[model samples]
Target: MISVKNVTLRRGVKVVLDQASVTFAPGEKVGLVGRNGAGKSSFFALLNGSIHEDSGEFSIPPQWRMAQVAQDMPETTQSATEFVVEGDTVLQAARAEVAAAEASDDGMAMAHAYTALYDAGEHDAPARAQALILGLGFSVAELDQPVNSFSGGWRMRLQLARALMCPSDLLLLDEPTNHLDLDALVWLEAWLKRYAGTMIVISHDREFLDAVTQVTVHVDNARLVRYGGNYSKFEDMRAEQMALQTAALAKQADKIAHLQKFIDRFKAKASKARQAQSRVKALERMEKIAPVLADAEFSFEFKEPQNVPNPMLSMLGASFGYPAPEDAVAGTPPTVIVKGINRSVLAGQRIGILGANGQGKSTLVKTVAHALTPIAGEISEGKGLNIGYFAQQELDVLDPEASPLLHMQRLAHDLPAHLRAGQGTGEQTLRTYLGTFNFGGDMVKQAVGTMSGGEKARLVLAMIVWQRPNLLLLDEPTNHLDLATREALGVALNEFEGTVMLVSHDRALLRSVCDEFWLVSKGGVEPFEGDLDDYQQFLLDEARSQREAAAASQRKR
Candidate 1:
């Protein structure tokens, strides 16, 4: 068992944990949650012995073998499989001993070392490493690719795979789902379920914590509070506790009234027959989560669009993908990702894009956002179509060196005079607008490059809401946001009177904001027949099939 008894941990002058006490059993899967900057990472640092408690006691079994994903970006020429296989310290040590023994001409020592290596599962190490890489979204063709050849996010995935490769008594994962797509996240959940070691994870993703963890540890006001259930149960307990406070009572009343109004209006207004059933389900879902959102410290809403356009866009046999390089030969063809897409995006429709990793969900969204033009067929955008797009890589469209104020100023300058009527181009006016999105005073002038990922994501959202777009194309917008901010976004999207198309691994967000799903798979786009649960099952089956295929290939070798 691991115990932190009245621990006082600090970083500089910041009191991260003050007399906090918490305990974990030998095989507990714990979800560590708190607001951003609430010392979740610091607490993790303590566990891994990267830092120590300034006062009181913190200890774990000395013999426990620990594994954690390295935060550093990997810069290596080693093949992906080989790199991951090396994560097993025991196996590596045993093999090294055997080599050393043989070099010294010690026959008995060599025999013992070889037996130790065998006991450490050296027989199937390659297959185990390959499985981990594949389960984390790597393709078969990329197994032998050098680690440094991949992008930053892909390299991070490799790091996660390597950590999972290690045989340990304890596993610590921090924001493990940030780089994963929906399909990959599903696979990871299953893998963690099968992990025998005691696990502690720090994640902003609500559904992820709920699915994989049986207990939740909340860092609140410099103390670690233990809860016996998952994240939802913790919220429920929080709601009950907060009910006793007068201020919280007033807030809850206001939110309840607000949700009641929405529910009443939603039932009365049925613009589309197909969406009626989904709306009913969404109302029930809202009622369940409203109290939780009401408990959040911050909130914002999307501005009403200037004009609403029905059937915001229509794609007729559209093929979306990357075009051939500019310097390519004349006859070189483009690489089509999602092809033969026939779909219509209407006003006020909430769509969740579903697909396995690398299956073109982002490609289709990019095409709609006009970031990438369709390689073939036609995209008929409605008259006066205005889109607010949030890329999966939010940094892609942002000027990292520019301040939040400067970004808004540039946006104001880019807008036509007619669109700039109410939103002023003046510095003070832009600053005030930025303030509405929580960018205040010094933060307004702070360079985005130095800001945290969550802040940058918030800046992107603020810019999107400022546009007053009729259609929102959000791709993994919640990747960097904390739980409270995510709840805020869910409420904001629910209140927005516009079309929404989102691609995210955060199931909670998907359930809250989206009523319909579009599947981008097998190089085509089609309406998904079922809900997120069904899609998760599909992903699981696919993962199992992949594992079997990979094992079979390994056997042949």
Candidate 2:
């Protein structure tokens, strides 16, 4: 349904896409993969016509409409329903024309309006809208909520719902699963599976890509390479391709060396000179294979302090919930969100918190970090426990006006003066710390506002690591990270000797880095001894049990 041919996109002097060609067929789900800053978002923007390429041939079939789910939500004060309804401009106009005709009592206008309404299938619009809303995880009551009232994640969902509601032949989604919970992600995957149009999604979630996409389009070194399978298949194919290329290159190198040796040895020999020259010419004409090195991997080595005692953070009979207004005391006992939470983070414990969205995972992390006081029960810290907390809303703690260096300097200033004695001056220490986080040279001087989301996250993490805390509390730490960075952080965390309490939806990272699972659900915390897959199976079993219990209850009723 859409084709890009010889597309060359440039940002200033940097070439993002060079003679890249790709095609999407109807009902095709294409997964776009690349490392961070490798022009995945730029490619989407070019396809969406939000930005024009320097030189390219992009084709969309005539009468084929397109919609893009943007990473940033558009600034708007409109109600969610209004925004979604407005997405279908023709339908909205037809409805308005129908209303006007009915008000004026014009017979000809009424006939025209009725025809328009019928042609547009106005009766089906409401049902379609409701389906889109629910599919994107919005409740019925939230349909009328102002778009501005929702957080960035929810607002992105609203934008996606609006795009999905539109009658588009092609959909362009960039990082659509970044903010989605597992349930919503499943819904989106199902929707795309049954969708009648084409879709191209740029996402870092391997599982989502595998579940939704049939083709993988890789953007590497300013070129587009298509792999005819899901992500896992693509990985296998890519590895084989690299190995073949390496072997071919090795053979070519051996041939070239042998030919050169022949030329050197037979330069004065009349009989062998012609054959040697032919070999030289063949070598010159041969297309040399470029080395297919794997993408650069990020390695995070956290410099944590040594030898901390057990039970870095512990809680007993903990209960936590946001306080309702005193005048609005109509609920029963304020509806405790989490209770009977008995958990401990020993010196070597690597615990992962898992649950659905808005299930008090963040609240539990805050309580463990001592950022939130539990309404009931006690929390205790071991002796000499140093804590490093990485909150989900990292931007809230960053100063927009400060440079990266300045931010680190301020953080360093808060450290004990005795520790700073051998660490050089404050500016030097900050620069050194920034370098450790891969923000060297000009990057350290850039303002925090100008930094990318990944950069800011890394900077915050670097600051935390500099303190060398004995215990760490991380909430959705991989939210803005690319695959390489996520793997790097996971490796670092897995190797760290300190206690860790993490809340994340990245199952791969959790499985690799965590030793146990602390699942928050239905107003309580349950400790499970296993990896993410085990916890996931536990959830599935629990869900099945709940369904059986409900059926039994219904039969009893």
Worst 10 residues of 2 by lDDT: 285-294
Per-candidate Cα lDDT values, in order, are: 0.88, 0.72
- The residue-level lDDT of candidate 1 at 405 comes to 94
* TM-score for candidate 2, residues paired by index: 0.79
Best by TM-score, which number?
Answer: 1
Question: Which has the greatest lDDT?
Answer: 1
| Stretches of model 1 off by over 4 angstroms after superposition | 263-286, 289-291
lDDT of 2 by residue, 1-557 (tens): 67888899988788999999888888888999988888998888887777886777887788878887755666888878677766775787788999999999999999999899778767666555555665565655676688998988888888888788777788888888777765466567767887788888887776678888999999998988888998767876775675576656575464445334433433333223322333233223211211221223445566656558786767888898766667885773554689987877777776778776678988888877778778888888887787889998876679988988888777767788744445654677678767877888998888889888888899888878877888889998987887667756755675576888888766656654555577787888887545444555555454445434444543563
Q: After superposition, how far is residue 252 of candidate 1 from its true place, in Å?
A: 5.1
